[model samples]
Target: MAQFDVSLVLPDTLYHGSTMGAIQGLRIKPINKEFWKDAKDFGAGFYTTIDLFQATTWARKPVVAMERLNKGTDPSAMVRSLPKDQIPVVAVYDCNSNLYTDNIILHDYRGESRAWAQFILSHRHSSTVDNCLCLNEFGWIHPHIACGLMADNDTGQIIEDFRSQGRDIHNRDDLEWFWTQIIRTREGRRLNGLELGDQIAFSAKL
Candidate 1:
């Protein structure tokens, strides 16, 4: 599996403590200090943000606060319950955001290739990411190249077939151009075999 870094940013000067103070003004029992302490000690927990808000016995208040936040309301009550002035920081390791789809090959290297394809298809993919890191160009491609299982025909065909069927294939142009360039420039490198099969199968199945 590929490893990645995950991070988030919260405005440092936002009204975090302000929201908590608002809650107190309403005579609502103060939320557990542990929650605030946790945010203070470790920014917000990625997994727990929604959970924490949901768990608060006061539902309407949190909802209103969140709505305010959504509407660009300033210093809403919910923000008060959170750590306001300080930016909570958390370091996530081995983060990933891959997703899979129906008809995607899931066996052998094919599964991995499909996953990688899905990732690059995302609008946020890093174009600068390449095989090697530096001078000698050794290990230029990520050692964990999930190029998908060895395919036989042009890889671009699968994307083309997907588009023909009216499915909004992700990264269609980028991947097509990338492979086109690779095939054009490389002396003998070819697209993966299963990818070609995928195209053929998709065409027949469709």
Candidate 2:
């Protein structure tokens, strides 16, 4: 069936797709903010997944992003000590189930919805301080553990396409203008089920 981190200390199994080769040490350190300048689906964190296929898809990202002008590494990845030319790899972290739960806030977005779409936009296009729960003492969204759909890496053109039609994604009118258009693509797959891939972003925080 399905497995949840019973102890809440960690998950029974979380897969990480990367090109960093063999991960050193037993610890999982999320990439630094400087590594990625773009807005992420769940802010910036160590993104993983319970779905094997999804993780496999992630394995392809590092490679594809490297060749493409858009990402392919984002150029500034050097600050994070990430390699530029390497094969994407999916590192399966088979976490052990234990018994411990406290001071952990996890927001799981089961399937796509208006709230989910809006949440992504808040992290990408703008900031929603009130809705953001991962804020720091300074009221900045440091982000928390968020489990949701993988952000569509190819959203730029989609945004531009809508813009050509004079549709502003940031517009709240016309029933959350942004969501109406996005749901028409991969993110909209929620209507049936996960068609692209899934992910769970683990924050750098302990």
Task: Find the candidate with the highest TM-score and give its number.
Answer: 2
Tens-digit lDDT track for model 1 on 50-107? Answer: 1222223222444454665578656444445555432122211221223312333111
Worst lDDT 10-window in candidate 2: 129-138
lDDT of each: 0.30, 0.57
The all-Cα superposition gives candidate 2 an RMSD in Å to the true structure of 7.8
- Which lDDT value does model 2 have at 170? 46
Candidate 1 lDDT (Cα, whole model)? 0.30
Tens-place lDDT digits, model 2, residues 1-206: 47787433456888876665435422444443333335566665667788877777767765455546554455445324445435556677766534434465677776767667766765654333223333532244554577766545355665555556676434666227656555555545333347536777766554
TM-score, one value per model: 0.18, 0.63
lDDT of 1 at 113: 45
